[model samples]
Target: ARLLKQYQTHLKKQASYIVEGNAESKRALRQHNREQIKQHPEWFPAPLKASDRRWQALAENNHFLSSDHLHNITEVAIHRLEQQLGKPYVWGGTRPDKGFDCSGLVFYAYNKILEAKLPRTANEMYHYRRATIVANNDLRRGDLLFFHIHSR
Candidate 1:
């Protein structure tokens, strides 16, 4: 229960980060475009109808997953992962029948749980757009962590 609560909080923070980051990026882009147009009227001879259309499209797709919805999904995913605790680790495996590698375990647990597909490899997961870099002190249960391991 405590872990679920921590996951819920983490989901809320992540959602807010994505939404706020996108909004700030859009604002910055608009400001930059305005300045560019002001400096070079001939370069932007026509009104920015294309830019408006792109912004409108982005706005239409900006809906974030709700905290309660994600919380329930995370709870289920955690349970699923726990059930696989004693399984053997297999490279590139993603299902219980085949066992799992580290990233494969995560891929099985959360991929498509909320209609979002996770990348197959840890390196890809680390670079995924929605993946945030949380401080070690800020980590909580259900939070996915990535690390760099040098090969000997």
Candidate 2:
């Protein structure tokens, strides 16, 4: 339970970082609404509403952006990955520019290029919701592939 809470907190921080470009700049549920109301008093709903309403308003105001941007983002991400193609593969190394493992390569590309905010471990990334389990024959772009190289 504690570990799950930790991951949830990390996920919230990552989302805040993505939205605000820095997690420290993100305001809490009430704070954001207060700012919005102060900025656009006529546009905001009446004050003293539920906290969830304030939180929802803040979330709805933020944009996830469009898929159109993703293609360009993905191309750029691939370019970064290609630059590391010739580097030596070390098991636990995270430095792709020098050398790193298979997992490290993906981690670097996502965090640097897209700010994808994936899990730190391969096992967690494999099971994460963003990585849908598809049949090998039905594979598509950006799909996370898994191979059973060894058994536990």
Candidate 3:
């Protein structure tokens, strides 16, 4: 349980870093655009609303799982992982019969319950497009975590 908690925390941190970097980049880009517009008002007729429209569309398309549903999914995954506590770690294994690797373990546990299939490897999971980065304090059961091991 402790190990699982640690993994959850690690995943939250990785996601937060990615999210923070994206927000910072967006802010920088907006500032740069503002400066360019100020210098050449004639070149820019009106402010861009494309980004806003994209965000609105994304929000409209997103489906949020209810708290109860989320909790049930988390419990199920954790239970599955706990059942394999003594299993050997295999390099690319994804099932109990063959043992399980890090990402494979996560894939097995949450993939079925989740709307989208997770990437088979940690690196890909870290960069998954649909991933949402929650605040550290908001980390809860069923959160998938990614960590850099020896720069891998």
**Among these predicted structures, which one has the highest lDDT?**
1
lDDT per residue (tens digit) for residues 1-89 in model 2: 34334444544554564344343355463466566455533232244465866565555443223243344445555666777888998
> Model 1 over residues 64-137: C-alpha lDDT tens digits?
22345545676878987898999998988888987999999999887745455778999998997656677889
* Per-residue lDDT of model 3, residues 2-66, tens digit only: 54565455445534432124666766644554554345332223443558654433233222212
Q: State the lDDT at 122 in candidate 1.
A: 90
**Which residue runs does candidate 2 get wrong by more than 4 Å?**
1-65, 135-138
| Candidate with more favorable, higher lDDT: 1 or 2 | 1
Query: lDDT for every model?
Result: 0.66, 0.58, 0.62
Model 2 earns a TM-score of 0.52
For model 2, state the Cα shift of residue 7 in Å.
Answer: 29
Count clashing pairs, candidate 3.
1
Q: Can you tell me which runs of candidate 3 are displaced by over 4 Å?
A: 1-64
Q: List the residue pairs that clash in candidate 2.
A: none
Root-mean-square deviation of every model: 11.2, 14.2, 14.2
Residue 90 lDDT in candidate 2: 89
